[model samples]
Target: MIRTGNEYRESIRDGRQIWIDGEKVKDVTTHPMFKPVVDVRARIYDLAHEEHSRKVMTYADEETGEANAIANRLPKTQQDWKDKRAAVELVQREAGGVVTRVGDETIGEMWSLYDGQDVLNEVDPRFSENIRRHIARTIKGDPFHISANTDPKGDRSKAPQDQDPDMLLHVVKETDSGIVVRGAKYETAAAYANQAFTKPTIANWGNDKLSDYAVGFVVDLGSPGLKFISRNGFAGRAPAADYPLANRVDEVESLVVFDNVEIPWEDVLFYRHTKAAAFIRSTLHRYSALPFVQRTLHLADLMIGSALWNVKQTGLEKQQAVQEKLAQLACYREGINAHLTAAIANAEASPGGLLMPNQSLLYTGRVFALSQLPAMMHTARELCGGQICITPDSATFNDPEVSPWLEKFYTINDNWVAEDRRRLLAFARDLLNSDYAGHRLTFQLFAQSPPFAQLGAVYRNFDWSGPLDLVKDAANLSEKVNGSL
Candidate 1:
């Protein structure tokens, strides 16, 4: 069931309404802003069929006798996680840059459906079955999937009914074929992806049994009323030689307009069930958080690499102070590494018989990776020196009149020539100092919901009773403390 790169490309050329920079895109697969990212996604698909990668990227499904994407397979054992991690690392290595939302990261949310079977079953077991089918389709069809949440929620003070009801994407009408939905979601890579695990954003966990706004479904991005209005892209903004990461790996976000879009009954995962909605909001990232945090690990590596290389070039490595700063960066990197490693080693079994990373370690790792990212970037930027910002563009480096003068000033020795130094600084700039770098930092901060929600996950998963018991035993408190427990 695995597809080739060309097949993946042809699938997204389905005449979906997509706009960027005030112009309607004719074809996402061929458009300038989207071509680079789409090509990268396609290359990931093609990698599976290649000789060396087939084993790493896919596993044979016993029931169907077909090689399915390993990323989409239901994790049952610790080895499944190790395989998924290896596949993700290999894909990152092959891409030459970090690329999230390729497939594996988003597919984990479907597994979250299994975690919520009890809540969703009260809505209807049929909806739960729909989720199961979609999970299977992801493995067999190998479609590009992405998460769709975070609507343009207007006036947080006012309820959806008080303001424009469409602001939160409520059900407009129910047809025999499906329910027609009206509203939007801000998502990355939605303009080109095949489908989305569209669901409710953060909600007030009230006891309301049913509401039009509390809904979850898998939406086909190419459907008739779906419109993609993408933010301006970072690619093609400047020369790739100077802004390498942005040009090849900047994932564009879009505000997708769903104007009376029809969701066939079969595709509806949950409808008019606030309990299901609240349950989903609390556990949406249970399985997905690992891959999301793993992307930050790659960013950590890039930051450390940029800093260490800069210090090495300037002979700063010999200084004890420089070594201490570099070691701090290593600590940050290994902190994330330790969390991910321990999470897998102490993996927990889910209610549905799937293996998830240890909940406490996984969520705590997310907080560590995201909460400290800005500071880490700052440290790396400082270590890279002031040259990353002050350096001229590639055009200036190759200029006939300026080239010789720049060469004499930029060159340190035969080993550290002007060109090599310029390249490293340019890379450091794109990784830490450019517009793309800032945008990426913002994306990581809130991509899996906001910092507060991440902390909430850790709070809920962490065993508070253990600390309470320890304090009670130490202080010799009355039975009242145990009653609270």
Candidate 2:
């Protein structure tokens, strides 16, 4: 069943234990901080049913033969990769490059893959059918939002098990029906968005001591013992008039607490299976990175457009320096898009018949995104100059007494209207100066991995030998030329 936007909203109308600012939110749909993000998600659901986007957003499951979220349908061939990429790009574009997080769809897709692995391992053939049905339901139904919970709190140097064990989400007990999991998953991005589909932050390889922690399972958001403590975004509270974008795009992060939460056995994908857990994490990381690259490309496109628009609005487009800056922003945007194109073009089928992007290229793309994104933000800030900070609040500009004086003084270049120019300037301020902007910039830096770790991953995965051999061959040719002379 293709769930409509309203239907999806209705599904989560019931009470869930979500806390914000030391208070439990009674209605997540109506909460000031959560409502805007929910609206954004609703747009995604609406797109799935729209005539124009339905084809890209919805896909028929080969296993169940039902139309579902393209995210949940694993890509099996080269065309499959293209189709999935198209779907991802469509969502990012529809959101106006505002919704940059790619994990939204990727997490569920990873879970579906893990579920498939479980189904294959089941001794009874009937369990495979059950698993297939579960996947179909997950794809078709509105599952809760997904957030990867890998960043264990505290010092990064310690292994998860070696660190304060309680900091990591580990299993406490087991039951006939399910297992009891206790501990917390921190910095979860979409804790307030849905009712189900949440899982642990990272994979637990089951050594004897870590056996209980090796569990992976799903739970409804309103499950008995689950609790969510929400965190604020920059746009959470500026007066609606002062910060319009803040009101619309305020994303909330929360610490998802599982206090002896019972997760049913059937839903458990990996338990006391360290090897499988490692595979699950690695597989998810590899596949999920592609969509993120696509999303980053979208963001680059927006930043570039916003920078260019600001330049033109300020009448600086003709300046050689301004044009050069715009061109640099354009180059960064195109570079990201180029890498995405390469990753998609070089995709290959996995053992499970799912299409996987080239690991090296995909990792390289992520590395580039993490390094390039902050500079892109910096460039936007540099181009906009002091104007972003100096722009008066919308309310001040709207005041009858202050309006004429402010407009007369602030309006730049005879071609641009004061109001229009102010709006763009305000937007740039919100983009670069606001807390939301800081959070977004921080998110991009560490989304795939930490900056240094990302560099390490690139070094480990990249084939320096081939490039070195080429260099050596060139050197030999140069040496031979000198000898001949």
RMSD in Å for all candidates: 1.2, 5.0
lDDT of candidate model 1 versus the reference: 0.89
Instruction: Estimate the TM-score of every prediction.
Output: 0.98, 0.87
Per-residue accuracy of model 1 over 31-140 as CA lDDT, tens digit each: 88899899989988998899989999999998988988888889999999989988888878777677888758988988988778877789999898888888888888
Cα displacement (Å) at residue 418, model 2: 1.1
Instruction: At residue 299, give the lDDT of candidate 2.
Output: 70
Question: lDDT, candidate 1, residue 56?
Answer: 95
Runs in model 2 with CA error above 4 Å?
Answer: 60-66, 100-104, 108-134, 151-164, 187-189, 195-210, 413-415, 468-485
Q: Clashing residue pairs in candidate 2, if any?
A: 149-201, 195-221, 206-274
lDDT of 2: 0.67
